[model samples]
Target: MKLISLLFIILLRFDGTTASLVKESSDKNTVYVCGSGKGKRYHLNENCRGLKSCSAKTIKTTREQAQKEGKTLCGWED
Candidate 1:
């Protein structure tokens, strides 16, 4: 039916817009890291399991700086 098709298109468009909004809201530029492993693991949240066992200090830094130092997303957080 034409109505069904139109509804589908509208739903699809709305879903896409909602997804973009969620992504924008969750945009985490700041990362938490422990001073170890050559800066290889960075977490978007401080409570990530990857940092739970960390004995060193958990410092906050930007994602760009973490990447520049060869850090990757923490397995537990991302």
Candidate 2:
């Protein structure tokens, strides 16, 4: 029973740590920018330049949405 409990705790900790790492990596990869005459936008992996800066938000969305919203903004192709 003790070994089982210990294993469970270790597994839980591992899972939580991995989850946080993934989230951090995702945020690091995401970027946002604004155009000279455009509005704010987000990009996954692109060099963006504009008046506005970029950041990561708690709200989650799909890549399609990011591309759609950031169309006016700038981004790196690969």
Candidate 3:
């Protein structure tokens, strides 16, 4: 009983750690967008379907700057 509980706790801890790591990794690979509507950051190659339309000039900007532009821009991989 004690050993089973210990194992369960360990498993739960490991699961939490894995979840956090996954989130962090995903965030690291993402680009942030600011301006227009609520303004939010998105991952590379993710669709920007509903956001405000952006121009080619905005698309050419660095990921961080693009985020500040607040317009729909294609992800780097796109």
Which is the winner by lDDT between candidate 2 and candidate 3? Answer: 2
Question: Candidate 1's C-alpha lDDT?
Answer: 0.78
Tell me the whole-model lDDT of each prediction, alpha carbons only.
0.78, 0.48, 0.47
Residue 13, model 2, lDDT: 59
Instruction: Estimate, for each residue in 34-62, the C-alpha lDDT of model 1 and write its tens digit.
Output: 97655579988776888888888899788
Among these predicted structures, which one has the highest lDDT? 1
Worst 10 residues of 3 by lDDT: 52-61
TM-score of each: 0.60, 0.29, 0.21
Q: Which 10-residue window in model 2 sums to the lowest lDDT?
A: 50-59
Q: What digit string (tens of lDDT, one per residue) describes model 3 on residues 4-50?
A: 98886667657987555455445643553433334443334323452
TM-score of 1: 0.60
Q: All candidates: CA RMSD in angstroms?
A: 7.6, 9.1, 10.5
Encode model 2's per-residue lDDT on 20-69: one tens digit a residue: 64555567545444333244445443333432253432233445655666
Per-prediction count of colliding residue pairs?
Answer: 0, 1, 3
The candidate with the higher lDDT, 1 or 3, is 1
- TM-score, structure 3 vs. true: 0.21
